[model samples]
Target: MFIAGDGAGIGGAKAAALAGKIAALDIACDLDRLTAGDRNAAARPLRRRLVKERAARPFIDSAYPPYAAALAPQDATIVCRCEEVTAGDIRHMAGLGCLGPNQTKAFGRAGMGPCQGRYCGLTVTHLLSEANGLSPDQTGHYRIRPPIKPVTLAEIAAMAAPEAIEKSKRSNVSTQVNG
Candidate 1:
């Protein structure tokens, strides 16, 4: 636990070099001692600190770069991976006078995928809004019709609950909708 840096009255390049070497050697010796120990320190139970729900966010957010330098899916990259539509494609639609997200969706087929509009809707809206100089609210996302499927009585019956079937039988709740 003894520090060897009595740097007082010691001046010039030679003393500076000696001091640096001594410091480096001291650090190296400490590292050797630590490594040579029983290594049982790691076997000790970890002291877990209780973190509040809101307190965790600052630690998580600090790991990211500053807002301006933060990374995001780039502009020409394929954003709607489901439909294989690039951000540039949606932007190009905007350039061609495509007004809103739905228009971009219709033109580029970006939001029409297995996940319906959920997957690509946000990316399409952001790109479309940015490209056309409109707000996100203005560039409205695609109108999602349910997970595109042929609705038949048999299909409905298979998926419907027993309670729903009995309730329907008791009342005229029309399950059919005009496709």
Candidate 2:
């Protein structure tokens, strides 16, 4: 799996686009869709542009560092607003031997809320790492399941249509008969 763009630590839209192109070229080469020489030829310009795009990142980051307060919120500060999980709650979980965000879910439904872990995952990890005296990498992230997108009641109801219900019944009957 190739992680380009911000995931690869190349920030900004231009840099991300360039990194994506480079990653695509590399993947194509790996799949033999493009020869190594051809891939290199195609990626040279993209790499140069990506370097230029990333040049300003240091300056931008220095100008606007991450919010320090977020890294170390007050005990009562709600880290996971969706589930109303507080920093103190996360620390408490750590004290109880919760080593990571995924484990914290079993202790308290922090990242299991509607937004999943999008907004709070980082904070949760940071808090857990601090409390457990481990690096964020060691603290780990959420075990992302399906339905990544928010499903409305109407969408769910649509899935329960007569045809789908019939399919479900047939599948269940098939499973039972096979068993």
* Top model number, TM-score: 2
Per-model C-alpha RMSD: 23.7, 8.4
Q: lDDT of candidate 2 vs native?
A: 0.89
Candidate 2 minimal-lDDT segment of 10 residues: 142-151
| Residue-wise C-alpha lDDT for candidate 1, range 56-125, written one tens digit per residue | 4466667853343111256667867778988778778888998876776678787777766666777777
RMSD of 2: 8.4
Candidate 2 regions exceeding 4 Å error are 141-179
**Clash counts for all predictions:** 0, 0
Q: Write the per-residue lDDT of candidate 2 for residues 5-123, one digit (tens) a residue.
A: 77678488878888889999999999999999999999998888888889888998899976978977999999999999999999999999999999878999999887778789989
In model 2, the Cα lDDT at residue 11 comes to 83
Candidate 2 positional error at 39, Å: 0.6
